[model samples]
Target: MFDYSEIRQVTSRDNPLVKQYIKLRDQKKYRIELGLFVLEGARLISDAISEGLRIEYAFVTEQAANKYPDTVAGLMKASIIGTYLIPSSLGDVLSATQGSQGLYCCAHTLDKISAADKMNTVGKYLVLDNLQDPGNIGTIIRAADAVGIDGIFLCGCCDIYNPKTVRSTMGSMFRVPLVDDMDYESVISLLHACGIMTFASVVDADARDIRRVHFSGGSAVVIGNEGNGLTERDASLCDQEITIKMKGNINSLNAASAASIILWEMTDEE
Candidate 1:
């Protein structure tokens, strides 16, 4: 039970917090500089709390605070600073999506582990090489979390904190371990040193069928860009090249779909 009396109301769009939320929502640089990210809706805020993320501030509309009392209570419990009540109209103005839920929060960014630290652990990993789509990145993160992937390695991928990506993750972002912005050579070295075999997902006829590949011990499956697939250098760095077999003229799967299929195969062996 939370004391609703403690919640402060913000009536002006020009309020510093409101202005800050708008900036954090739209600017990646601001997010990076501040070491914070914005999450929307009670569902995501609840997920962040469940994961024990350090929430800095919570902003809710008067209607939402009253309508979703339990959620507001949870946010209050999780918010280290305080919970704020904004007008519903202001929530609409601040939202990135249609039909805003009128619940939002700012939380500290999850700390990323170094490649060396992450690679030392024994488990399956998903590697994204220069993947550009925020939806694909988020979907892959969700899939990885679902299948119990040990970690995700992002090399030249889109910002994981992008609002679209964060929304698409649907809360899985907080549950999974992420390693971002590593170079290929460093990643390959670390993986090999830790006895983790790297498998490149490719569409070429010569690539081995994913069905036949045996996933044992530590392993990583690399998913490339949406449009270009893997670069020659990246593909060559992988210990093996594997492909999902398809019927008819279908030669490719979307990066996220491809990741899901490969993850299923890899995890099924465990």
Candidate 2:
């Protein structure tokens, strides 16, 4: 257990740690440089603690610390570096969410999976191509976790550590293994080398129906961007182009929705 007496209380926004929090909340480059990302809200912080993620620091509003003593104690115990108390007003300024949950933590970023790591795993996977929305990426990660995807390969997607994305994952972000920022060609080569058949999700008449497509061995289903779908070049690299069947003028689905359907169909669950 953490010693409550050791908690440092900071009222000034000019505090060095507070400044670092602001930078981490706003800039992706800062997070990259520090190799740390900010997780806000009690639930997310608690999730990080439960997952045994290395927490560099934790900051809680004074009011929250008082109201939730047990939670504050838990955070203090989980914090490897230290825990600090900030004024509620300062908490509002530091918060990315609208209401300000009064709890925040800084955690080390998970390393991106390498080609060697990808080659060792053989199971269903999801490939995201140029997906821009943080929420969509997070939601997809959550769904991928639910359906037992072996891994996720992100090509030109938004930062997975983006606060919105982190919140949307509801802690699944910590559970999922992700390969970040690879080009289409390299990903395809790696998949093929691993003997994983790739299926491209497209909206074309020539594409095979998703239901009819056989997922025999290790497979990958690719989901494209929100507006443009997959680039022609990327779509051409896959073993087969597949589409979810639809009717009544509804030809497309949101990226997350489409991925969920594809993941469900591809899932080996009985």
| C-alpha root-mean-square deviation, each candidate | 1.6, 2.1
Candidate 1: RMSD to truth: 1.6
Score residue 120 of candidate 1 by CA lDDT. Answer: 42
lDDT of 2 by residue, 1-270 (tens): 334577988889898888998899889999999999999887777788888888888898877787667768888888877889887898888888898779988889986667555554458888999999999999999999898778888998889999999999999988888888678788888898888999999999778999898786789988888999998888889999999889899989999999999998988553
How far is 52's C-alpha from truth in model 1 (Å)? 1.0
Candidate 1 lDDT score at position 65: 80
lDDT comparing candidate 1 with the true structure:
0.88
Error in Å for residue 31 of model 1? 0.7
Q: lDDT of model 1 at residue 180?
A: 88
lDDT of each: 0.88, 0.86
Candidate 1: minimum summed lDDT over ten consecutive residues — where?
Answer: 113-122
